[model samples]
Target: MAEKAIAALTEAQASEELARLAHELARADQAYHGDDAPVLSDAEYDRLKRRNAEIEARFPALRRDDSPSDRVGAAPSEGFAKVRHAIRMMSLSNAFSDEELQDFDKGVRRYLGLGADEPLSYTAEPKIDGLSLSLRYENGRLVQAATRGDGAVGENVTANALMIDDIPDRIDGAPDLLEVRGEVYMSHADFEALNLRQAEKSARTFANPRNAAAGSLRQLDPEVTRGRPLKYFAYSWGALSARLADTQMAAIERLSKLGFRTNPLTKVVEDVDAMLRHYAEIEAQRATLGYDIDGVVYKVNAIDLQDRLGFRSTTPRWAIAHKFPAELAWTWLDGIDVQVGRTGALSPVARLRPVTVGGVVVSNATLHNEDYIAGRDAKGEPIRDGKDIRVGDFVQVYRAGDVIPKIADVDLERRPKDAQPFEFPHLCPQCGSDAIREPGDSVRRCSDGLICPAQAVERLKHFVSRAAFDIDGLGAKQVEQFYADGWIAEPADIFTLEERFGSGMQQLKNREGWGEKSAENLFRSIRERRRIPLGRLIFALGIRHVGEQASLLLARTYGTWEAFETAMVDAALMEGPAWDAILAIDGVGRVLAQSLVATMNQDAERAVIDRLVALLEIEEAEAPYVADSPVANKTIVFTGTLERMTRAEAKARAEALGAKVSGSVSSKTDIVVAGPGAGSKEKKARDLGLTVLDEDAWLDLVGR
Candidate 1:
């Protein structure tokens, strides 16, 4: 076809052509960047690029800024706040072959007016797959933290940043203003643990460490962010008032002095060839590394030279990110199956034909939920197959840049006639209970709770988790064995194990896997856990919706087990407005409140609790300090911010001295700490003829 004829086409025809080109380009980009799999060869991309360029040259006005021909890569997302970077963060151009890399080196030398014989050094470090963040510290304290929104702007996440233990709050001998750029990442171990926890809670599990870090940082509630384990590794600088050392190695050393966590694998190389060698070394050990890294980032060692090279509209001339080729292969989805999680979430798993992707054997991939399988596109046709995934369907499996494998597409034509639509079971596969999907949720949960063996075992494991009891020598397997042997049925049984098993000591010693030393160790471990704090004890109870932090909050509020139990029973019996007030605590949701009441109402569980309480040496509840002592020995409710301390600290301090902290402002509420942002609780307190204290009053009463 003639160029003029193609250029002079009708707008409708031109648009259709552009749409086709866009789709082709997008697919190519997804394959190359997102999936690490290049569907189109480099020669193919070049041909498409040339054709796109010709069309754009012919129809100049029709081209968009986002056009594949003009754009270097994807634009940054807007989920975060925009920051105007003091120094623009630029992406690098890539080289696929050794020849291309050599040519690039030659061009660099030519641009720098240097001879081929002259020696040049470069720093090579792993390009982590994580969310980029800029941390700005002023006068030794962390002042601002932002996400890399665009190369220029980012989202402000100072509050959430405070939760990361690796990111220091203060650095010794730091400049007046320092802006350090780093990657917020999750370690492989932490990621796995988080996924396990998510499965237990029936929550959405993240696909990879990078996604997990990104999702955790973007949570609207800072309190929620506080619970996730995140780490930071300084990689580069955005803006620093103080000058860095002459070499990249020196700059990293300086960053370490400033208390920033720098990646230990960073090394200075003598040339691009050496840099490539470093890349190979890192790539070879990628599987053994604690975090996911997709490539190596190479930058000019000298800041002055970097400034001289300047930058393109999107990328710096001095730096390059050399990415490893993606591991991809076509695999068939042989069947669909469901796995019952600890929380009874029926996870649809695709059983795929064995294939290797990213150096790992990929047999099974998560299919998310049934809704995702059945959802339709704007065209009213199924996005993948006309029908939901069925047995014996030829489905295309994909392992994207993410670690989790997924079913990307299905070939319906190749599906066998005998194939049947997969039916999600209505009963828990592990426990045989009727699976119950909550009103607004898609996950089908087992309502068996502590009664179900699987759930009970999981709960017991959680009770002794690191954040909970942290009992030594009492691991999950031990707990399961003890439970299975009828040695321990309730939480109380654990405290009395040594005494109960003492008489059978000789028999236990003679049994396989039960030596005198092992029995002694178990007893020692149980004894060490006997004096656990109120928070740990409450968490070990495994109340639904009650996490470690929430358990601590309740412990601080009620001070003792007796007080907490009495308050819960009283709140359940309260009427109308009084009942609503009891449920208004920051962590006390309706679901938790209902679960508490239901559990308390169960005679079987209640009897166990009473027996446990009787056997244990219950400590006295701490009294809240009050100058006037008007509400002494009475329950009080606090809402909103307090000038004296955070709500958490205040609650903790209140219970320490002996005051019952109730969630709601009720007729029984003797006093209320009504600080800034006090909500209905304050009003309810007033209506009920209860005394309310402002920030100053609360501080005065607490004698702070």
Candidate 2:
């Protein structure tokens, strides 16, 4: 049966579809990018994203804030230091069909106001199926390497990247500063050899070359990455002090000349027909290619043309990835199982009869939420034609560079007579806690957060994560082992490990996989993390809604841990100047504000905080300052439409110059940058006798 068209969907239906797409895509992004374990195949993920785009196009007002179209990738994984990209590493829009490719070309011509017969050229190259890496060099020497995390920020993997033979440590003729972007991949031969080694060691093997490359490159220890047969192919560039080339093909040649491996199949084509022909040629040779090639990526050849095309929020208009067809197969749905996540959300996983899809054996797939199994969305809107999945039913499965396969459709005709509708549990399976779905939430959450083993163990993992205390020797595996052994229970227990188990008969050295030296090293790592930054300490608490950014915001707001604690204690009443102050923060809303205050006010949580505080030396957040800058350490408020730059851009610029950007105009505001259509904030600023400047005047003052 044909699926319902986007034009045919009601406004409510479109909204519901958008919500479902957001949830699924967000989870998929986190799994694939963050954990390096993808649950949904790329093809299915793309289909849902395409549907979301079509619906948003038809009903513009229904576009969501967390829209899939506006996002690039998942946030950086937890166990790595984050590096903000100098220039955002944008994702390319995808084209699954030749017609879509044609639309891309036509869209480019339309944007540039060119005729159909306009002379234009494009570079078509094979899109490598591997992790995206950005290498930063200064003075022709390698300085940093990062993963394409959420585009804006990425994981710092400089040491790991330096170990790859294909990457150059230095290039004498390069610009003073340059950011080379490309793919880090493993060959088919290497992947198989790696799996053999894993089997010999009784370790889990990777699902594919992509996963192997990602897992290898993101290892905490650089020596692990050095042992992996990893290679890099430089195809693009990010931040650069000077232009390397004037055209896409020329840039690739320049990168190749600069001691970087460039794909041999990359070619400049004169027209859309030539591009399609090249894509076909590449597809034919894909099997013979030593590495994985997902599809052909096409980009405008001329640099000037690309600049003219510009970019959308997430993707560049000048380029598109023409993906290969997805692989599919039919299999039986053996059963359905529920698993609780760190946040206590009950996620359903489908157990399928082992079958081969895309040359990989698959047995499990994600069911997203209970609503997904029931064949409906959160609002009870019909999905998959209202065909609920049941045990012992034949289902169509698809695979596209993913570890977990996706069930595309269920065959009701083949459903077993004894199979019944699967009942989603009302209680947490791990702890027997009441699992209640909030009014506006999609998934049921366990009420007993503190006592639940699943949540507790996950929180311990987060506490030792890269952005938190980052105890070098204490990783997720060690945390789990210690927790299960009843040696550690809370964050405070980690500080007392040396005292409790260092000298006794049950000493850490006596444990399996631990030597005297290794145990001492672990204790040293723990001791080293005793003096932690304020932002990291806040993020380590595992409070809901207090993420890295919010933690930093709170740290900057309060300056010191003592100030933050005192303010939170005062704000426990939930109504007062203290609470109002938290609500007034630039980016923090009432939701986050309330979460921080409530967590600090809880007696159990407060005790935990006190215990950790007693053992650790928390550092104060240093005020940002720029020499001779007028707005240095001053508060500035932006009001109305700024024609020169976006609000985000303005705020970033202000922050860069050591000026604090406040959302609302207050008596503390030193300057107010107001543009046309300035409203209440601007009026309030003027009434308060604060300095006011137009966009041009503000720009001039900043010397932009």
Candidate 3:
């Protein structure tokens, strides 16, 4: 059996395939973007995404709501606070071949209505393989820093960002408010040195410079980030108060003048051929650049042209990334092992014989799920010609953008005679809990919640993780040791460590690895975190589907621990006004709301919450508001078309000014901005006696 061709697939078949693709891509996005770990090779992910796109193109109405085409990245990780980007950060479409690059050029020309004879300039630069960071400067002073998490919201790393010397603290001639977007990366030399230090301490070393740079920047303690050798390269801008320049090249130059490190290899190319040549040059110099780069990015040079081209749901139409080819190597499949995560999801990892992929040693790859090992997709569609992989088989490994390689294809002819099909476990390997898969979810999970030691230990580690309590000198290793010794079993036990262990039969200072000073410091750190913010506490609880953004949103919605707790308890019934209120949140859906309510109602979990609450002072969530803006705290609706800016731009501007932009016109809407072709929403606003203004009047009211 083979995959059905996009052109030959029926509408029902396409819909099912789209659903399958959405689920797989969502998991991949979370692993890569949220966890900073990629599960699938870039090539495999790209191929599936491309297939989904082609299917939707052929059957236009079969697209799913959670389609990969509409998503940029995963939600922000729970380890840090969340930052809502003023302007949504977008991903770029990719081109892997010369033909794709040519097609991209033609597509841009067609979108802008420019003829081939008309000259069009594009800027080409190396695509750095590192974390995307947005640095905001207000009144020449660096104010905030964020990672590109899910495009709309990101992790706040301002404190960690300040430690990087490449980021200037102040600029004398910068705009009143400017947001410079760039990459935060570690050089190869620095990465090697850092790994050597880790190895000396018997700690885990990073697989690549990208992972090291990302992990370092996301450290809970700013001092740890400060100790790492990290650098920044500014390449773009967002939410600028004033225009930096008219062209992309000039804008890069302006950023460089503002004390930002701009890439020296950036060049202006006149046509597709020039773009290709520049990309070739960059690829030729890739190895000697002293940093990692996987591709070259090409963007329309003229600001007006880029604006005219606008954006797709998740990517820009005016720019594309020319990626390097993926690397492949053959190796024997040694074994398959299952690892349990904090949420009790049992994920499988494939152990491979020693092999080198893309200049890195590879010994393991992701098995994804049982369905993947059985040579069928989620929709039961045949893959790899329905060839099931087994131990002792010769497997092809490939690396695209992932730090870990993935099994691409298997050589059936080379399969060992003693090879047998691998059987997935029906019970948790760590605790013997029943392992079950839920409807619509592909991964199998343990039935035992916190009772299992594996889950409990992982949850404890998460509780003390950088984004959570962030206790000094208390890391994953320490948490595991404490758990193994029965010193701490739950979140509440962590607070009682000093009281329970000090002057007891087994004193902490008398422990093999601990001394008086270290014990005292750890106790002091625990004491310092006795007063925790509401958002961090919520995230620390390790509730399913409740990440940093969701936790903050819940905190902001309720403001206090008491209010949040009471609301969750009331919403447990799942059919009242309380439940409706939870659903009313912009980002919270039925699944997330249900998870929060159920966790609150569970007796065991409630006891844990009560114990933690008794020992800690939870701060109320502060309202994120711009006090000086006239539209602050107001609800606004935009209708019809605007000549001055795109709808997304208007929404972003409104959000930046502290106004809430709503899609529907309701009585609660304080203002409505109407333009040409004003529709029923504008009429409804007028009927409701709401303030309705034209686009120009609305712009003037906001002082734009």
TM-score of each: 0.48, 0.77, 0.73
Mind sharing the TM-score for model 2?
0.77
Model 3 C-alpha lDDT per residue in residues 1-704, reported as the tens digit of each score: 13354555655455545655665676678777778666666665666677777777776544543568777887787678999999899988788789989989988776556788799999999999899999999999999999999899999999999999999989978889999999999999999999999999998788788888989999999999999999999999999999999999999999998899999999999999899899989999998999999899999999988876777657888899998988799999999998887777787889999876654567887676787788876667767888888988899987776645668899999999989998988899999999988664567888998898888998898798755788887888999988998988998888988787773324667788888788888888898999999999998998865656567767876889999998998888998878777775645655567778999999998998898889999999986789689898787888898888767667767876877666667666789999999889989888999999998898899886
Tell me how far the alpha carbon of residue 395 in candidate 2 is from the true structure, in angstroms, after superposition. 2.6
Question: What is the C-alpha local distance difference test score of candidate 2?
Answer: 0.84
Stretches of candidate 2 above 4 Å error? 1-40, 43-125, 133-172, 176-179, 186-206, 212-231, 238-241, 246-249, 264-290, 295-327, 502-507, 573-580, 623-634, 645-660
Query: By TM-score, how accurate is candidate 3?
Result: 0.73
Ranking by lDDT: 2, 3, 1
In candidate 3, position 460 carries an lDDT of: 90
Q: Give the better candidate number (2 or 3) by TM-score.
A: 2
Per-candidate local distance difference test: 0.66, 0.84, 0.83
Better of 1 and 3 by TM-score: 3
Which is the leading candidate under TM-score? 2
lDDT of 1 by residue, 420-521 (tens): 767777887778888886543545677786677767676677566544566666767777887787877667787787787683467557767788887777
lDDT of model 2, residue 697: 94
**Which window of 10 residues has the lowest lDDT sum in candidate 2?**
1-10
Question: What lDDT tens digits, residue by residue, belong to model 2 across residues 16-78?
Answer: 456557656766787788888877777677776777788777876556545778778777975
